[model samples]
Target: MSKPRSLSLAAYRVLSWGVRNGTDKPYIPRPEGELIWIHIASQDRQRVVEGFCQRLRQSRPNLSVLLTAPPQADLIRWDASSHPLVNLPSEQTGAAREFLDHWRPDLGLWVGGGLMPNVITRAEERGLPLILIEAEIDIHVARGARWLPDITRYTFDCFQTILATSPETVRHIRRLGVPASKVDTAPPLHVSPNPSPWPEDELIEMTHALSSRPVWLATWVQDKEFISVLSAHRQAMRMLPRLALILHVADMSETEPLHRRLLSMDLRCVNWDDGGTIEDTTQVILTSDPENLGLWYRLSPVAFMSSSLERGSGGRDPLTATALGSAVIHGPFVHRHQQLYDQLNRAGAARLVRTATELGDAVVELLAPDEAARMALAGWEIVSEGAPQTDHLIEIVQDSLDQRGQDHAST
Candidate 1:
């Protein structure tokens, strides 16, 4: 009812542009079966959706599903082109409502980890057996919600099932008055999309064609972390003559500035956007798309989750790298993804550093075949632990839907 906030406006414009110019996404086709709608609104939402889909597809591969997320890509990215996903418009009322009205999914799954109030209320009115998965509640966000306490309470109440990432969050929401019966505390899902079509032949060819030397990925790099990455690159090249670096920024627009930085490093740089490659002597490849990181992750043996070099970044996610069978290295500042990093590191799946020098050293050390293999195996095991959670989610959803059918029969 009020004017859209700046974040809402920006997200609206991006989603609007994408939906307008975007080719029509084929509506998920299923008749006479239950439908699922997953609303994602946070940076980690993609992982949740992927995990949900992965689990649902396993026992019931033909189940119809729709995945939607916010348009803030640098923070969270959801590309529907290759999967059963749709980019939900962010204005929060008109487009979101229209999407729901059309599908009228039998069961609605809202990972409102970052949802706006209007979107939450709209789904609530439909009484579609809503499940709020991995809901988050922290002090900073609670303070913001204080300005609209009633709306926040109402949103939490909308869910028939409220699954949270931790006991603390579950307690926080209960303090806000959501019934305890509606809540479940569990570890959030951590699934990353596997690169499809193998890309194996091309991947191997890309590796060999790019460099026979050791390659390390500086993934999801942003402005705050670029200078340090460049400096590390220059310093790293001096000792490891055959080492190659891949700089994949969070935003593509950062590519030009990254190239300029490369010029001063005295290293031959290749730009993926410019259709470039690593020559026999090439030192770095600047890739500027977040989507392509999946491919690069599969290609590289060791990767440094970028954005961790800066103080406020909290950190780039290590789960993605772990899921792809690469040894993950992150800075000590991964607070946003603290739980995931903790799980992986505790499982011997990842390593952490406090500075660029330390990160550089770790990168070189992790490239060793024996060390890399050991880390890779651990990383895979960590990711595999998520399968059980995924299984539990599907069982719960199916049982709830079945119970609803039984209630109707009794009535």
Candidate 2:
């Protein structure tokens, strides 16, 4: 390394250390409600943390959650009403101490990797009950060794319970001196189901109006995949003339053009934004409002998750459809959610289709009442499997807080 650059880096670190330990303390009063501190390293895990917080709050209404993440995380995507978001402190003891002193969290839940050894060890020393969820042990251990020699063992030992997402991670943690009993393998955390925003009365009325008609939804369809969706619909329509489709375009601007194209094909359609009602002859329901997806997912017996037909889309999450009781069909390009899709496929909850013809065939097969019902049941099971892990973590947090309260009283 260049001498000048090395000197500059050292000076910057010294200045940061001085500021952290400075006498001028930042004024941050503790909240009246019980606080739980959650540290996440990246925004990719935002959905998991958000779901955990929501479930946690439902069980303990008075509990306040403080989510700490690096500045690069997508903070804006999270709902501020659910929890207060804060930037993570530098990995220095002085900074960590200052943050813990101000927040005074009753418990700590560290999610994902990038463990800050100094902060974690300090919190453990301060009697904080710490739990690590979905720990990436190998990555954390390597990173820790790079900067803080031999700190990995001490930090991994601090967690009261460590939930590793894979057997490999469990092996790594155990090798780092964490007791085998303290660590266990678990599936990755799943996002909590968001309630359907559509009104119940409307849903019931729509259900009656459609009256046993075979229905399918093409969710979040990009313009490039319109041909595939429409072709699949047309092919399926040849066999079941009464089949209805809910075409939800990803872009609102494409809604008008899509409506025109459907008209050009002489297919009867309804525009959701224009308050058009579904009639017996309506073949398609055109919409661009993403919020209304819950309604379609609930109504449709089968759904083809779009954005995966073309390359670079990485596909949208199919779990939402599965959670809402829809049998899923998608294209092969789902690298973004490959693990999820693979699990669903193995569980018989989802099907992969490479071409529009295959998509049509899959839809037709799943349209059968027995087949659709079977897949829907499997999908529901996959979605519900994560509840046990979430509940267990919540119970641990509640127990820790109860113990802390008793200790305070005795003291």
Candidate 3:
């Protein structure tokens, strides 16, 4: 390893020496396996990183991942049964040492370039292979650090590879004297274009049952929004008598009660989870099985992503719907998936409906074959545009891990 040309890191360590690292040790001990540590500079990158992790798991099979984000990150929990998220210790020597010792990850990935001199240098010293993606380095610090020396280049030596988000970012990194070969321009991470697979026979059967009727899906619907969704379906049906709705409750346990509730609302319905069949007169198909979502996404032309209609029900990820070629409809209260919903809205790939009446109008309008196809095309562009970039990053990570495994074996 080459020595840093400046004493900036040393001065930084001294300045932050006594700062208390607010991060706590996790209750779960480190499992014995090949673990990769991923630290994000901000919370917005959490979903993208999680997507990358999913692909990584598919490739590596048994690899474990540990995710860390800054203190300001208020990430809503999702399917974390396997991957664990924890607070990253503050960039102090003691905290860094304790964290590195406790986790002892096989590899580390720092996203959006929140380089901590203490943590990064320590990791490098321990021979951890580190990769930096979506680099957003503060290059002004290179000249601003006249008191100590070039700061950006000083810490960058720790990373084995660095992929910048844009050509402008590449120029900025290059100006700081980082090797051009190490800095490649890559696009921002996106939700994977390929979603989890569903049973194809079911999609075929559902397609046959529906007989190409104008269909819409309301997924992750909460109990509070039952009336709103039901009312929306009723209003839409006034325009298109053949429109069918798939009402998926967020909580599966509510299936029985929701079924009973729909019956009371005078809506002709079928409970798919209870093995009820969709009849020609069926206006609503109810389900809570997550596995069936993929089938519905492909079957439906338009999807009203529920949980956003009412507050406290964090908005659902719309990428799956879009990736599977369904036009998206969402509400205003999308705190969890704010960025994603905004992206779709801006691209004209999705419609925003704040009320049941508005949702009904939008659904009725979008369910037209041509209208739905146009919107689904727009959404498909949003997800597919980032596919090559995501695939490249996956390859980078896989190669790094493979090389590390070989090195460990040799030693």
Candidate 4:
């Protein structure tokens, strides 16, 4: 790659220097292994970055991902075990150099709704293999530097590849002097994990056990939302007597209490978590394990993403159920996964219910084979929208990491 034009970086560096401020991230010692350092250029694009990382890890289980974002920090942090997110280092030259020296990544992913000239150039100086994903035509330059001449083209040179969001973006990148070969269109990394495979025997057994019963899953249910879910089930049952609810408790400790409450409701309950099978008259099948959700997602054509009807539940992720072709019913309190829910709702992939009656209505409506299939297909389209692009990005990362590993081994 040709050297990035300085674009008055010297003046910009001097102007923005020497203030220990918001961009100061905690000193998270870099983990020992092959690590991909991702700069989430914008918070809105973080979900796509996460979805990409999740799919990438499936191919490389022990791969470490260090996600970084600007100091405003709407991007969700990963758990400590996985690798927590931190602020992107200050754009000042010194901080940029220090950050690169500290966390020498195997590959650098520039999640490009924006760009950070200083750090990106620094990464290039350090010979990091950089790839920009979700490249938008409108370049988002860092604040306080719009007065500076547009160095966007020079910055673009630092990347090994740029995956543009559209043909327009691809054209724009070329207009900015990026080589056509290095810029190609790809879809945004929309939310959804790669669909996990369930045991064929188990799926077949669950199918035969239900004898083609109309099933809906109510998963990640909190205690406060428990009765509302059950009430919704009872109300929906009035319309379809054969409907069954796979009720999963978010907290395992609440499992027994919830089970007792179900029995008190005069609902026939079976503990699927304890190897219980659904009886012919069973109205509810209970589970507490999150792993079991995969099986249930496959079994049920419709699912209620629980814990939202009650305040402070913050909502659960609906992507997994949607990824498995399950039409979703969610409540209004979806602040945690708001973007995802909004997209699903907008696409008619998910229905939002504020009350038991509404939920019951949604369940009944989605249960109609055509309605359920339509909703599920809509959800699936959203879930799998960027799949081919995601695969291409994954391949590039994998091949680069492998080559980096080989180079290190030889040295």
- Comparing 1 and 2 by TM-score, which wins? 2
Task: Rate residue 360 of model 4 by lDDT.
Answer: 91
Quote the lDDT for 20 in model 1: 24
Q: On residues 242-272, what C-alpha lDDT tens digit does candidate 3 reach at each position?
A: 9899999999889999888888888899999
Question: Which lDDT tens digits does candidate 1 get at residues 216-244?
Answer: 88887878887677667666766777888
Once fitted onto the true fold, the runs of candidate 4 whose alpha carbons sit more than 4 angstroms away are 1-7, 19-25, 77-83, 137-151, 167-172, 179-181, 275-277, 403-411
Supply the TM-score for candidate 4. 0.88
lDDT of 1 at 17: 34
- The collision pairs in model 2 are none
Which is the better candidate, 1 or 4, if ranked by lDDT? Answer: 4
Estimate, for each residue in 117-221, the C-alpha lDDT of model 4 and write its tens digit: 778777887778899888875444456776776567767878888997789879888988878889988777766577679999989988988997899999888
**Per-model TM-score on C-alpha atoms:** 0.60, 0.76, 0.91, 0.88
- Ordered from best to worst TM-score, the candidate numbers read 3, 4, 2, 1
**Each candidate: RMSD to true structure?**
10.5, 7.2, 2.9, 3.1
Clashing pairs in 1: none
User: Which segments of candidate 2 are over 4 A away from where they belong?
Assistant: 1-35, 40-50, 61-90, 93-106, 112-114, 125-127, 134-150, 163-200, 401-411
